[model samples]
Every structure is written in C-alpha cells, then in structure tokens.
Target chain A: MNKNINHLVNETLDSFAHLQKVAAPDGLNERILQRMNQPKGSKEVYLFRNAQWLIAALVIGIVCNVYLAISYNNKGESNGTETSTISSFESHFRLETTTNLYE
Target chain B: MSELQLIAELKDGNQQAFIKLIDLYKHLVFNTVLNMVQQFEEAEDLTQEVFIQVFQSIQHFRGDSKLSTWLYRIAITKCLDWQRKNNAKKRMNSMKSIFGLDGHQDIIPDFVHPGIQLANKEKATMLFKALKQLPENQRIAFTLIKADGLSYEEVSEIMQTSIKSLEGLMHRAKENLRKSLEQFYKS
Candidate 1:
C-alpha cells in the first residue's frame, strides 16, 4: 500500500512536469505570420527578378569579347595579304628592269 | 484553425494559419523537444523549427495519418537531427561534468525544500532530468503517450511502427523510468 501511494505521488509529479508552463516568446507569432504574408520566391522570380542582371551582364561581356577577337583576327589576315601583294609587285618591277638592261 | 485548415493555409504560405497551428500544438512539440533536448530555451527553438518544417512540408502530409501524429513524427525527427548536428558531444561532455560519469542517473535534492515555492514546477524540473536519462526511443514513446495523451494507435502511426511494437516500447519505457526513479530516490 505504501509503495502504491509513493508511485502515485511520483506519477503525479511526472505528469505535472509535462504540463506546459513556458509561453512562446512574444512577437514570434507575428514574425512568422509576416514571413508567410510575403510572397515566396518563385522560379520565375529567381530567373528574371533575382539573377537576370548578372546573367545579362555576362552574356553581353562574352559577345563583346567574341566580336573583338573575330575582328582582330580578320584585320591581321588582311594586313598579311596586303604585305604579300606589295612584295610581289616590287619583285615584278625589279625583274622587268633587269630584263630591259640585259637586252 | 483546424489541423486540416492549418495544413491548407500552411501550404499556401498563410502565416497566421501557422501561428494558430503553433498556438494549438506548441505544447505538444515543446514537451517532446524538452524531453529530447532538456535545455528549456533550446527546446523552445526546436519546437519553432518543428513548426517551420510542418509549414514547409505541409503539402506532403497526404492526410493518410492524423495531423497530430504526423507532427509528432516530424518533431521527434527534428529533435534527433538537431541533437546529432549541433551538440551530441557537447551534451555528453556536459553530462559527464554534472554526473561525474557518462550516463549516470541525476540526483536532484530530495529534501523537497519543505514545500518549495512553486513545488510543482520544481518537481517538473526533476522530471525533465529523469526524462533525459531514458533511452532514446523509450523517451519518445513515453513522452508521446504520457505527455501528449496520444492513443497507442496514434503513437504507433507517429512512430511508424506496429501496435505491438509500440506496446513493447511503452513497457520498456515504464520499466526504464521505474529503474531510474529507484536510483534517483535512493540518492
């Protein structure tokens, strides 16, 4: 009987411990509510709204670099062609002058 | 709001609905967390996180089980995750420092202070300490059954186990608590 009474006391004590005495912190509910009221970030928002400017900047930079590289390569090729033409013209003139003198 | 309504609003990012859910179930979550974490403030934070997860994953609820049961599972998993991630070793070390042995039963003063102020609250503190000593699953089962007043079937569903398995868990939990109490009262 004594053991049974003691068990009851302990059970009561344990159950009381489980009772919630602590309250949730103030304004935390409001804070969670506010976050919910705000729109969640969507995929479209991520693509166009969040990272669009950075992506656009990267694309523009790459295009400009490619255009510059292609134009520079073409300019070098054209310059080489002009140099070869001038050299060939000078050689022809030299050959004609030599042939005339010999004759 | 009803649990179903909370689930609907949570899926839609309705924060007030979430607040209402928390207000309704915070005690249950906090009690479970307090058993797992033991620290009061940390338990409260974990309780909030459990609700956040419920909000984030409300769509997955499927309504196959009671919302309370599902939330109980989520709360328990969150506690385990937080423990494994944040403070597993620190907790063990702190326990060692306090008890002078790894996993020794705690000995709060037994005199009872001749009716201490807020005696219920003081005993509650001791109960929390005793709860910390229980094995992981036993603690979970015991808290879900005793603290939340969940039916055995509900507990089985929340734990994702058979009813027979929950009975075994509850039996073992009771035995473990009895043994721990014997040790606590002896000192």
Candidate 2:
C-alpha cells in the first residue's frame, strides 16, 4: 500500500512537468529564416568542401580497407603456422566475445 | 490540397503551398522536435530545418511513409546531429579546461519543457528526463508510443523492428524510466 501510494505520488509529480508554450519572445522564426537564407558565400566553396570531405573519406576508407584486408590476410597466413592458430571453436565466438570484451 | 498537389505546386514555384505545408506541420514538427530537444527555440529551429530539408529532398519523398513520419525522421536526425556537435564541443572544451586553459563547459541549449504544465511537475520532468536518458532505440520507441501515441505495431513499422523487438525496446524503456523516477518519487 505504501509503495502504491509512493508510485502515485511520483506519477503525479512526473505529470506536472511543463505543459505549455510562451511564444519564443517573437521574431525568433524570422531570425531563423534570415540565418537560413544567408548566402553560403559561394557554391564553389561548398563544392570544394564536399570535394575535400570525399577525398578524405576515400583516402581513409582505402587505407582502412587495405589495412583490414592486409591484417586479415596476415591472420590467415599466420594461422597456416601451427603456433599462431587457436582452436576452431574460437572462430564462432569472435563476434560475441569481442562485444563482451568492450561492454 | 493533396500532398501530391503540394509537391507539384512547390516544384512549380508556388510559394503559398510551401508556406501552407510549413503552417500545417509547424506544430507537429515543433512538438516532435520538443520531445527530442527539450528547448522550445531549438525545437522551432529544428522544425524550420526539417521543412527546409523536406523542400530539398522533395524529390525523394517516395510516399512510402506518411509525410509526417518522414518529417519526424528528418527532424530527429537533425536534432541528433546537433546534439552530437554540441557534445563534441563540450568534450573539446573539457579537454582544454583540463589543460589549464579557460573555456566554457558547453551550454546545453535551454528550452521550456511542455510537460511542466501538468499538476505533477517534478514527476513529469523526471519521467521525461528519464525518457531522454534512454538508449537511442528505446528513446525513439518510447517517444513514438507515449508522445506520438502510436500503437506498438505502428512504432514497429516506423522503427523497422519486429513487433517483438519493439516490445523489448518498450519494456526496457519503461523499466529505465521507472528506475530513474523511483528515486525522484521516493524523495
């Protein structure tokens, strides 16, 4: 009974949180539109920024993909050596164990 | 006017239809945004942003989802992006501060939470804040269910999850909110 009363009180308290708006002191909408409409200087600048991002992403992706491919290749090659191999059971657990390790 | 008609009119340079669309969803957009971002002004800005994005991507409106849901998705994504940028700023500022450099602790944008108007103000804020603190999937699920009043099936549709999975999210969300609010209530 006490717990029920406590929950009701809590629910009541939670329900009391703000429930109305006072217009954001006016002209806020206009201000937002004005900022939005502001000339972004030049399309060339945007295009250049996009170009830079694309280039950087491509470089990073290529490097990372290459690194992963090389690393996996190395791991596979290393497994060819008896000393570097773990049990076959370990392969199935890799994803699960990796997640568990981080969490 | 038909959304199709609106789109056509917008494409053909009918500024009136464009404004009409904005007027139609302004409240819904602002309210949906309010759920994600606690502040009113930020919600308004996000609403404007959602409209602008819809205009930009009007061609991609496949009509697979309701216009409102698509806008909801856009507004939520934009808000999340803004939050990420703000969090990044805070992290940088904190790092600088730790190094004996003077910097601000990054302001979380202030906005009035509409839930406070209820008679049970603290409880409502506690509930909403707890809702906000949920994991992204759970948070979105809770919003769709509680704020938007969508059924579990509808939420599953919007979230692209199986109904069973959505139930799990909703359950976790409720549990989280209960846990977070228990203390507030106890006090």
Candidate 3:
C-alpha cells in the first residue's frame, strides 16, 4: 500500500511531463486585431459619454456653493445684529468699547 | 524581425507588426492562460485580452526584461484577476444560498488539460485539483515551472522573485501536492 501510494504521488507530480503546447483558438488574431482597432474612447470621451454624471456632479457642486454662500450671508447678518446689540448695551451702560483691563 | 524592432513597430501601432507579435507569442500566452484558467474558451478570451493590453501598453515597455518575460507577467496577472473574479462570484453565490435566494451554485467540473499525455490524464486531473488547493503563490510558481515549461530563472524574472525563493515555493508546493495526492489515492 505504501509503495503504491508513493507511485501514485510521483506519477501525479510528474503528470506534466511531455506536455504539448496547445494553440490559441482559430481566428483569435483577427478577433484581437478587430478589438484593437475598435476605437478606444479617450478619457475625455469617456467623461463626455457619462455627461449625465458630470452634469449631476456640477449641479451638486453649484447647489453646495449656493448653500454655503447663503449660510455665510445669514451668519454675517447675525454677526452685524450682535455687534449692534453689544454697542447698544455698551452705550446704555456708559462702557468704553476698548477698555484695557490689563493696563 | 528583431524583438526590439517588433516592439518599436508595435509601439508605433503598426498592424503588421502586431500580427507578427501575436503569431510569435500567442501559443505561449495561450498555454499559460489555459493551464491557469483550465477552460479553453475563457483562456482564449483572456489570451486576447493579454495581447490587446500588450498592444495598448507597448509604449511603456522599458525593455528591462525580455518581451516574453513581460508577456508572461501580463498573462499571469490577467489569469489571477480572472480567478479572483470567479472566486468572488462563488462567494456571492454561497451568500445567496445562505439567504435562501435562488443562487445557482457554480459546480466546477473536473478539468482535463488537453496538453497532458493520454496515459497521464487521470493522474493529471488529480494533480490539478491538488494544485488548486495550494496557496496562490505556490500554485503560480508551480504552474509556471511545470505546466508552462518555464525555467527557474525565467519564472523568477516573470514572478519578480529570487530563484532561491522560487525554489522554496516549488518545494512547498510539491510537498503539499504530494500529501494531497497521497490522501486522494489512499481514499
């Protein structure tokens, strides 16, 4: 049994001996050449081909920019209001705007 | 034509040069892919993809290694990619099965390589199954060495490994393959 098993292992390992090289399928060269000549789309062309995605991305970017601008304007208005309110508080309390406590 | 001249023509997109290139190396690429993929139709497709990639990227060929070595590298890479994709599909199918979906499980049939000797077909089939069970690097090294008939130096160049490292991989592969075959035969 040991010898038989050893024989099987060696045979299996050497099974590739005298292997023949198989040729590629018929007309594969022609098919490959045809594919090669298929006019590959350039990166710019690919981007153009997915113009919808590009448009969607542009729309999203514009929307984000508008949202940010609106938020900034609102923040600026609120800051102005706060400055006016502080000014009013200081005047009412007769407080100087630039009091130097450290001095 | 000389390899350098052919490469230059291929880089220039010369149709005749490309045809000559295919004629020169198609068998090597095809046999390497066929042994790895074990399916004739798929190997043929992958072989075409390899040459197409070679044509497209020939300009980048720096002539650091031989053209055949570069071709081997490209063919092996494509085969590995195909195997990874198939494995992922198998994983997906199994996941679907677990979810009780109608997953058509892919049963990989026993592969009999057409190039094997007539008397060694059965043994070769068993060996192939065992080869599949090996780690990816071991299997690649072994396949390139044995089935693809590449010398250690050639395979090392293609694999980008030292010949000593390749020898280690080959040794481990044979050891594991022997164990697998022994168990298979005993059963």
Ranking by lDDT: 3, 2, 1
The alpha-carbon deviation from the true structure for residue B117 of candidate 1, after best TM-score superposition, in angstroms, is: 9.5
- Chain A TM-score across all models, in listed order: 0.36, 0.36, 0.42
Best by TM-score: 3
Candidate 3, B10-87: lDDT as tens digits:
888898998999999999999999998888889999999999999879999999999999999999999999999999
Give the Å shift of residue B2 in candidate 3: 0.7
Give the winner by DockQ: 1 or 2: 2
User: Which has the greatest lDDT?
Assistant: 3
Question: Of the candidates shown, which would achieve the greatest DockQ relative to the real structure?
Answer: 3
Q: lDDT value for candidate 3?
A: 0.88
lDDT of 1 at B87: 54
How do the candidates score on chain B by TM-score? 0.72, 0.87, 0.97
- List the candidate 2 regions with Cα displacement exceeding 4 Å: A1-36, A43-103, B106-112, B115-118
lDDT of 1 by residue, A1-103 (tens): 5586467547644654335434555665665555545777888877887587898999999999777666655554666643343454555578789999999
Show pairs that collide, candidate 1: none
Error of 2 at B45 (Å): 1.6
Ranking by DockQ: 3, 2, 1
Error of 2 at A41 (Å): 2.3
lDDT of 1 at B165: 87
- DockQ, 0 to 1 scale, candidate 3: 0.62
| Candidate 3 lDDT, A42-98, residue by residue in tens | 989888779978899999999997776666555546656433434444443454434
